[model samples]
Target: MLRFLDAGESHGRGLCAVLEGLPANFPVNIENINKELERRQKGYGRGGRMKIEKDSVEIISGLSEGKTTGAPMTLLIQNRDYENWRLKSQEETFVSIPRPGHADLTGEYKYATGNLRNSIERSSARETAIRTAVGAVCKEVLKELGVTIRSKVQTLYGLNDTFCDLFDDGLYDLIEKSPMRVLRHQEEFMALVDSAKKNGDSLGGWVYASCEGVMKGLGSFMHYDRRLDGILSGALMSIQGVKQVSIGNPFYIATGAMYHDGITYEDGKIVRTSNHAGGIEGGISNGEQLEVYCYMKPIPSLLLKLPSIDLKTRKNSDSRYERSDVTAVVPLSIVVEHVLAFELLKEILNTFSRDNKEELLAAIEVRKIRIGEIYEKTTDY
Candidate 1:
């Protein structure tokens, strides 16, 4: 199975992720990985931590001369802000009251810990940095096989009408240029963010992600656990602050007949009139672009605190506030993109002959031929 285990606290020495199950001989570019890390750090409304930590991945193992050797890959990302936090110590940063909309309360209750700092450190979104590095590595592998994944912020604070389509031409460029990662309403988003900051509040939004060039039948319908949509949904929901996930525009109101895609043929290739199904059917990829949208909640650590009770003092108190983004939905697009990429890579590996890179590519080509033959025979009949 393709998987990774991540460790280290948000403000600890650094973060570490060990990823395994990739095939041998695939090339890796540290620079490309670092570029992805940099992308995750960008976006307006970010906190001072972003300015302090410059994320770059170091490969501790699994590659020989920039190529995979079929061993577990070890990735390390040093926290530049670690030294600053280290001097403060956990006692100094101890938390008595939990933050609202965060794991602090539940985690403290579950673990029976008095200090919420134990929960806060691990539950922080800062851990996504290492996960993003893993996703970047998966992206390189997927790129070699002609797959491309991308994502952008589709809405900010429930303002959806001004967003751009994910498949629009030059959408990526447009998102890169905008601080909010939206194709339109850049000024409005900035203004709202400024206002939220002034009011000591935070914002939430939707991130739309898509993967192109994934072949059909990557997942099996025979098993519920093996369904592609189920797997992808689980992965997306696992991200910090992500509360809702949909394969496509599931929220759109339509009749059963109008909601689904219509199959058609164009230029001797099968196509769909609409992609409302988001490129998946019956828990399997249907040779269409895989599209997903995730709704991330506002950052829990607000300058305007919520009501809570202090564990130490046994008295009513406001929730603890930490340094956090006014809105992280912009960089969240990057995280969503990479998270989907990693899941897709895992699905591809699970479905194909993946002992090595060459074998995996040949298997994919063969699967494509088989699909073509099946379609051709059915069309002829």
Candidate 2:
């Protein structure tokens, strides 16, 4: 299985990630990974940090002549803002008050420290930049196999009942060009973000991600740990500020007829009449588009600080102000898109298990043929 370990502080020297289990001779592009990092930094509500850091990946190992050597890969993304922070004295950078929705207090309790700066540094969303670079590498692998992943901000400030079609592939172009990553209501979303920024507050929203060209049976139904939906949802929830994840259309209050996808026979193949199940059924890919929805809570580092108690003084005080976005739903859409690429590529590698790129593609093609045969056999009955 593919895996990666990332380390770095928010304003430390830089970010580093060690990725493992990629097949040999796969083409790896540094520019593509840099492009992903650029995408992660864009959006209207972004903070001054984005202005200072031009995020890019530096491949330290595991590639020769632009191809993988079947060894572990090391990636680095240096933080430009770290230079300024390094000038500050240790006492000047200390944090005694913890943010309410952040891991500050709990992290201090876990480490038995009065200072929450250590917690804040690791838990910062800046860490996601390295992960995004890792996923960008995985995306190259997926792109070679004809998989396409896309995402968009479906709602802002908890607004629902919109007419946006989350499943429409045509919206990809519009979403990619829009700063807010919304299919429509761009002005409304921007206004909300501007209003929140003016009020020294933050806003939360929902992001939708989809993947296509995934063949059947990437995950197993026999084992609980191997379920694709569970695995994907867990990976998504691991992202900072992502509070809830829904695979397919989350219809906890609906009947089977209302939520379940119906099957139909089409040209000797079994097809789902609708993709309400989000292309996954029985813990496996059903040869349809995979869809995911994530709800990201407002960032905890609000400019207008919420109430909190000082760790040393035990007196009530407002939270400390930190440089942060008013709303990150747009950049979050990019993060969601690439992160799913990593998970999907991991599952594909686990299922196919080939050490060579050509051999892996061949294995996937054979699986596709097998799926077709199985579909035909099922449809005949």
Candidate 3:
């Protein structure tokens, strides 16, 4: 079974991750992993920290000559910002009074610790940096198998643009170019972000992700746990601030019949006229592109402070301010992409059922042939 564990605190020296269960002889690229980390740090409405830190990963073990050795992969990302906090002594303790919406305050309570620092530190978004590094490694594996995952922001706050034509001619290019990493509609989006900052508030938005070249039958309908959609949803919801997830369109239209993708047959091939089900049905891939969307709630760390009780004094007081983004939905989108990529890669490995890279490819080719044969022989009853 493929599994991974991450370690490090928010203000610690760095984050570390260990990923095990990958097959041997898969190509690894350190530069690509660093690039993914860079992408996660980019994006508008980010806080001052992005300017201070340039994230990069160093492979400690389980790889040599740019290929995996079929052993546990260990990675490290040094925190350049750790110097800022190292001056404080252990005796000089600071208490947290403000609780973020999706953080581990409740967990701290269960442990009965006055110092919530450890709880919030481990629960921080800093952990996702390691996750992105691991996902970048998975992307390398997927690329070798002809599969790719990509994502983009779909909505900011209440403003949305679904009309593909209305999007900037250079929308995707702008996403690549802009620090905020948002697509077209930048002027408008930035205006809103500026407005939010002026109001001492924050906002959240939606992200759309897609995967291409994933084979059919990666998951099983016979068991609920084996459902691909369930796995994907769980992975995405794990990200902080991600409150809602959907495979496809979540809106209701005037006509009920218009909602679902209609099935069609052509030249001995089964196909859906539309992808309203997001390339999945009955917990399995349907030989179409996989689509997913995640909705992020606004970050709970507001510049306009709210009332709270100091953890040490147990007295009423205003919340403490930490360095946080006005809108983390942008970076959260990238984090969602990585989490989904990791889970999807696991599903791919499960489907192929091979520990070696070449063996997995051979199995996938055979499976594709079998799918073609099944489609050719089956007819509508």
Each prediction's TM-score versus the true structure: 0.97, 0.96, 0.94
* TM-score of candidate 1 versus the correct structure, residues matched by position: 0.97
Model 1, which residues run further than 4 Å from truth? 161-169, 379-381
Q: What is the C-alpha local distance difference test score of each model?
A: 0.89, 0.87, 0.82
lDDT of 2 by residue, 50-80 (tens): 9999998999898989999889999999999
Give the higher-lDDT candidate: 1 or 2.
1
Best by lDDT: 1
Error at 105, model 3, angstroms: 2.9
Clashes of each: 0, 0, 3
Q: Sorted on TM-score, highest at the top, how do the candidates line up? A: 1, 2, 3
What's model 3's overall lDDT? 0.82
Q: List runs of model 2 lying over 4 Å from the truth.
A: 160-170, 251-254, 378-381
How well is each residue in 54-132 modelled by candidate 1, as lDDT tens digits?
Answer: 9999999999998888899999999999888878956788888878889988998799777788899998999899999
Off by over 4 Å in 3: 90-93, 100-104, 163-171, 252-256, 379-381
lDDT of 2: 0.87
Which numbered prediction scores highest in TM-score against the true structure?
Answer: 1
State the local distance difference test value for candidate 1. 0.89
